[model samples]
Target: MGTKRLKKQWLLHAVGGLLMTGLGLSLFGEALIKKWENAPLWDWLLWGTLALLVFNAGVSLVGQAVVFRVKLDGRNEK
Candidate 1:
């Protein structure tokens, strides 16, 4: 198995992504709940699209964190 290496910046991306994901989900749930309250179609469309965009951005960030570059064993060794 290969060793795993991570950078501090990546941690920020991961944490931010998690927060964004949670926020997006909350927004989405709120939007859904609005249906029972008879919210306007425009309101639903706005919030729903915003929620999806945020969720997708979060997922993209998380994917970026996972795709970071790393060096394998050998050349750098003394």
Candidate 2:
């Protein structure tokens, strides 16, 4: 059913977002601990990429939550 498919998609997005957040945090922590002051361009690039990943994950999670909530509210109203 459509509801089942929606649930599956939401679950997938939630899981993917969590994974990306975890990975981004780990990378960020490692970079901080290693003191990236004198790190090469590649290291900075990696950090920037991780930061972007975290930001993107957060956005995706929030977007999914909003969509799910709207769908749930609509169903309840019907």
Candidate 3:
């Protein structure tokens, strides 16, 4: 029950993080290097977004792992 929910959450969180970072990098493409000089705001925005996504993904992974470990340990020992 809760284990399944955690698993789903983990998947979504990880996928979301990958998508965010990938999308930003893809959009930047060859012009990414120029962002530093022409548009510092956009550069910062992209970096901040990626950082948030990564942090969320990491938290989700840890949470899911803990939930799963508890559930597994609680099972009948006989």
Candidate 4:
């Protein structure tokens, strides 16, 4: 992908990850404090989903950074 597209994609992923993480934390916290008997399963599911989103976001950002850095390094070497 082009640099701009890649950057946009990274931004989207990062934002989505942050939003999901926040929602998951809020839900999980509410469930814990409220002592809902049926919440345990849903809590675990939300956490797992949040973890995946954050992981994917982190990997995408890191990958883009490394690619950009390599490009810059190559340009400087020439």
Candidate 5:
């Protein structure tokens, strides 16, 4: 890929990761808070968000890998 395309891909990967992480944390926020004791609400929120971000980062990286693999395969077929 060209530098511009590569940068775009990276940006997409980042955006996708952020989306998934935020979604995961938001969906599970309440449950997480209930499971812990003496935990401030903001603390739970922060932890949940971090966990989601980490999860998303991993998933997005995998997604980027798959995308590159597919592109490579297509190029080889030509």
Candidate 6:
């Protein structure tokens, strides 16, 4: 694949990761706040778990983007 294409993919990965992390955090917060309102135990667990998964996925994506960036930089140095 071309360098430009790789850069675009890297950018997409970074942006997607950031958005996923933000959304997950927001959801997690909402789930936590539900405790004060006497929400069901299962509801809390479900939302909290889902949010964590999303957050983890986002972090992984961001990590991949960093790897791509590092490899690209190395190539540029040659």
- Alpha-carbon RMSD to native, per candidate: 5.1, 2.7, 5.2, 5.0, 6.6, 1.0
Candidate 3, pairs of clashing residues: none
At residue 9, give the lDDT of candidate 6.
Answer: 81
Q: Model 5: runs farther than 4 Å from truth?
A: 2-35
Worst 10 residues of 4 by lDDT: 30-39
Clash pairs, model 1 backbone: none
- Each prediction's TM-score versus the true structure: 0.76, 0.64, 0.47, 0.50, 0.49, 0.92
Candidate 6 lDDT, 15-66, residue by residue in tens:
9999999989988998898866789999888889999999999999999899
Q: Please, what are the lDDT tens digits per residue for candidate 2 over residues 1-78?
A: 366666676677777777777777777776675555767767767776777778677667857866875675576678
Lowest lDDT 10-mer window, candidate 3? Answer: 25-34
lDDT of 1 by residue, 1-78 (tens): 233444554566788888888889988998898776889988887888889999988898777666542322232353
Which candidate do you rate higher for TM-score, 4 or 6?
A: 6
Residue ranges of candidate 1 with Cα displaced over 4 Å: 1-6, 69-78
lDDT of candidates 1 onward, in order: 0.73, 0.71, 0.57, 0.59, 0.66, 0.89
Q: Report the lDDT of model 1 for residue 53.
A: 92
Arranged by TM-score, best first? 6, 1, 2, 4, 5, 3
By lDDT rank, best first, the candidates go 6, 1, 2, 5, 4, 3
lDDT of candidate 3 over 1-78, digit per residue (tens):
665665565566556656655655554452455465576766756755665665566556556556655654565332
Report model 3's TM-score to 2 decimal places. Answer: 0.47
Candidate that would win on TM-score: 6
Question: Which tens-of-lDDT digit does each residue in 1-78 have in candidate 5?
Answer: 854565567666757766776666664665486546667777767776677666767577758856765665666678
Off by over 4 Å in 6: none
